[model samples]
Target: MNPGVADAALEGGSAPVGPRRGRLGRPSWPLTILMIAASLTVLVPLYFTIVMAFKSPAQIGSGSGLEFPSPIVWDNFARAWEMVGFGRSLMVTALITVFSVAGAIVVCSMVAYAIARNWHRRAYKVAYIYLLSGLFVPFTVLILPLIKLTAMLGIDGPVGVTLIHIVGGIAFNSLLYIAFLRSIPLELEESARIDGATTWQVFWRVIFPLLGPMNATVGIFAFLGAWNDFLLPQMMIANPELQTLPVVQQLFQGEFNTEYNLAFASYLMAMVPTLIAFVFAQKWVMSGVMRGAIK
Candidate 1:
């Protein structure tokens, strides 16, 4: 055949295959498609919630359920805030979250440091087991006991709720921290000790900074728990004034006058602090989790 005829034949025919053609070896169009489908499956609910949050009552009320709002109502947030007393609730929740998380981090860190480094005896082990027992004992089982205990202790308001969180959270939080602490190089602490650093100084200056990522990881989780905690606050605090954001946000939907649009907005509002905390702590948080997992 002529060169031009051969070239034309090659062009008309398919290009020669470069590699093996099995599902594992070949370009996996099916697998890629499956992964994309799975991702959308997971993200669709988040997408739906975000879109619904931005929609108007008229749009939600229309029963389309999936369509965008005509007006794109932004004032639903303000209405939600007022109807729910969201500001006051947020303040109370923030106070509780900040204090509880800080307290948990401090107390848990100290306990973890002791258990991780200094001592590992039956006494410490038994005490740790007693703390960890909280994880097995469901909060539902303890509700009555806790009610009576709180009444006896005169710890019945937001303060009571914070204390409850600290108690409830201690076991898991301290375990994670202590597990991570075991991974820290003893040489660092030893060198600090040689330099005449006191126990508190060594903890505050050296070990503490090294634990930054883990601390942030623990803190964001603790904070979000406290910020979004509904049951403890609702059960412990009878005064409407003491209600948290989650409990207060519930006010938007009553036996009557169920404000779905405002309810969605309030839900979004409740997410704001957690969102912010994640944004700021993402790097360290992820690193800490990976480090802990490795250890």
Candidate 2:
């Protein structure tokens, strides 16, 4: 054989190249620009929110909105806090978020586990498809019926709101959970069963613990959804005193007047918890998504 051919054969068919196949390609400028633009859509509003939140009523009208507050007034937050009944509304929102997150994780995980394990069975398969079907239906289409039903059931309050959040999240959360569950080996459960563990024990001990990443992803989503929900709490919680933070924040805006500074202050406050949740859980969420996609 020729020396060149021999060298090529020994070098896995290609001995030299301009760029190695394993090396990453150059960054796509257009994609990078698009992503930056998309991110600015979020960051710009946030910037304005922080600016408006700190601006005094005088500073707000005196100059462009991009200008920072000269004195850095903290009174907007205080005034918004008082006007919106921030303490009570915060408590109500927190409770609803906590319950909604917990319920979504537990219920959706269990349902996903059952469907995934018994996918060959007709009943479970039908139920799985039915649950997924909910994803196609818009929430607004059901709001009127939901309102009437909750009223009839005498749960048209925070309790009803929390319940609806949990139920509404079932479809999407279960899809994530089921996809992640597929990546888990059935051998683990079988081993647990061989050690005298019942199906329930096998799940709670062997399976549930392994679902930490996906749980974080689902929990964060549920927390954000429940916390940021405005329409449901606004329409359902009949008593003004029992309304959620988003609903109570409406006090800063009306037909004839709007307190931009105070409204932004309240908006900033309401979004802080969600920001914290996402910041902490983002890693787990990415890992869960990657793992689920692998299967």
Candidate 3:
């Protein structure tokens, strides 16, 4: 091909890929502006939350929530902690989150492993499809039915809420595990079986170890979902003393009145654990997503 023709052809071929960039290889201004605007939607609220949490009641009333407090007040956190019974709620939330994450990982991984290995069979294929159907069902639609079912089972408390979280996550978590499991070669399990390993032994000794990245990814998601959940705990937990932190934080709100400082402080506190978990495990999440996507 002629050099000039080749250059023109290459440029023309790539032209439809995306919007054109501006001078100096910068992205188009419209795209940059749109991204900035989208980012502000999150950043602005985060800024307000931090500022409001530190502000005194008088300061909160004197200005819009944008300004930093002249003298930051630690009392809001102290009051929010006491009013919400933060210690008890935190312990309950942690127990539910830990149980939910562990249960989801073990149960979903086993189910996905079974389904993935037997995918060519009719029964497993049907079972996989049946589970995947759950992804489309909205939680709101199940709430009323779940309320009745839990009451009947005598689990209308934190235990019921924990069970719901684990069960609810099976569809999505199994999907991730199944996808990642596809990328793992059957030779590994075969080698284990050749060493006189049983089916359960093969899975435990060979397959489960290899799912570390996907497990981290799933566990992080499960932790966040269980820890931050409010609706399920509020509706399902019969005893008011057993509510999770997110549900307990409702103390700061009233029909006609709100405690901005206390509410923001409580929210900030609840958000910290999630932020820490994501920060530490973010790389595993990315790697797991890429591995899952590959097969």
Highest lDDT model number = 3
Candidate 2: give the clashing pairs. none
Off by over 4 Å in 3: 1-38, 120-122, 256-258, 286-295
The lDDT values for all models are: 0.78, 0.84, 0.85
**Candidates sorted on TM-score, descending:** 3, 2, 1
Q: What TM-score does each of the candidates earn?
A: 0.78, 0.80, 0.81
Q: How much does candidate 1 score in TM-score?
A: 0.78
- When 2 and 3 are scored with lDDT, the better candidate is 3
- Rank by lDDT, highest first: 3, 2, 1
Clashing pairs in 1: none
Clashes of 1: 0
lDDT of 1 at 284: 55
What candidate 1 gets wrong by more than 4 Å, as runs, is: 1-32, 54-56, 120-122, 276-283, 287-295
